[model samples]
Target: MIGDEVQVAFTKYDGSPHWHIGTRLLGEDEHGTWLHSPAGTFTWRPGLAFTYDRANVLCVPRGQHWAATLYDGGGASAVTTYVDITTPAVWSAGRVTMSDLDLDVVQRVGEEPFVDDEDEFELHRVRYAYPPELQAQARAASAAVLAAVTARQAPFDGATAARWLALAEPAWTPVAPPARPAG
Candidate 1:
């Protein structure tokens, strides 16, 4: 449903929790399922919890190893776009999940897009024992996403996100994520 709330969860390669957030279903397109997270939407991790300061639209592309969140800039962080290289998303009744590969492609306002978190990715690759094939896939996905974002490709271009955000803003309501389990 267009206005239904959905939980988006991420896990590490070893299956530990990474991030979980709530978003509203903002419909789908040729690209994939689009989700809307308005400002103040709660996000949770193992020992962290906070709300986003700016609205963003997340696109979970079908059968793709990467998912993207396009932000409406001018917030405390200048990050205008973030694409996570991950395993293909698994979708269920009211939730979606993916294993974060740690390599991220980011584009900050007015700056060239680049691949971020390579150090974390390298550390985790050894720590998690990511297979050679998986490592290759992650690296390839990061490079591809960085290029697309730099070229202002559709969806990464903000035009697609703007349309979905417009549809969602009017009916948007704040939704809290499930409470994080005590350590």
Candidate 2:
């Protein structure tokens, strides 16, 4: 049974057009008809393609720049298992890679703002603003993490990757959910 939804946003190479890539979800309605989110209510139609198959352009694979997060009717978080549509319009045999993604912690924890003369500050409860440099570092770190997983065909180590990425990009924030209600 489909449990959750994965949303990915992708833009063209030249920064022109963009579209969303969404995962298919299976749910039972109050009336017992199987309803598919993003596709509206529908029953078995033998020859008709499934929602996911019809929205094949959205899935991106390794090497593609994309923002992705998963929702469990709750909120967004890092994703692990995802349908890979990473290959360009040439490949025919599509596959899903179950590599773990380790979210970077520094990005998770964010950055600390320090006063010019202040040497020490409170440890845990401190609230600070992330500088622009930090945010860039974080993005670079994220790219590195993606590269590694692609090379090793493994999941990212969340804490380390997050920390490294956070070092560069202080503006590490998780993807925000769309304002529209989930279907």
Candidate 3:
């Protein structure tokens, strides 16, 4: 099922070393799909990757980024939602993948939704070697996300996610995943 717990992964910002691990599909809609963990997971990414790794204590195994809330999902909470912002996720049956577009939306209880690590975005833009086309796309997408988040649009406003959270509650029934033929 699309919303079921499955192992998945994405490229590091540098776009090498493809690694797919575990997380839930959450749900999907016109806005896009969401990946989440009730207790975050450790996403292995380097600081140079411009990934959000605040208060990182684990780095020996690999230069790790803390996803302190991703170990599991399908649970709903109004407080402390670590919404990962990417180029959206593409799903096929029980599998999923997305680009690490280098920005994440952290929606907490009372605070306004804010995009994390914009500095990382700029730093990586110069530090790493992103192709010109992907560079343009990333900049445009990042800007658009910032603008929409600033404007509090739809899902970014907290309303849509909140609604989804309610729907993801344990008692809520999950539907059979839709067929995602390879395009």
Model 1 Cα shift for residue 103 (angstroms):
0.4
Q: For each candidate, what is the lDDT?
A: 0.89, 0.27, 0.46
State model 1's lDDT: 0.89
lDDT per residue for candidate 3 within 6-123, as digits (tens), equals: 5455555665434344445565566555444322333333232222221111000111122212112233454344434444455566655555656655555567766687787677
Candidate 3 stretches with Cα past 4 Å from truth are 17-21, 39-88, 104-119, 126-128, 171-183
Candidate 1 vs candidate 3: the TM-score winner is 1
Give the worst 10-residue stretch by lDDT in candidate 3: 54-63
Candidate 1 lDDT, 19-121, residue by residue in tens:
9999999899999999999898889898888889988899999988899998875579998888999999999999999999999998887799999899999
lDDT of 1 at 106: 88
Q: After superposition, which runs of candidate 1 have C-alpha atoms over 4 Å from their true positions?
A: none
Residue 33 lDDT (model 2): 12
Which candidate has the top score in lDDT?
1
Candidate 2 whole-model C-alpha lDDT, 0 to 1: 0.27
TM for every model, in the order presented, reads 0.96, 0.22, 0.55
Q: For model 2, where is the 10-residue window of minimal lDDT?
A: 116-125
Better of 1 and 3 by lDDT: 1
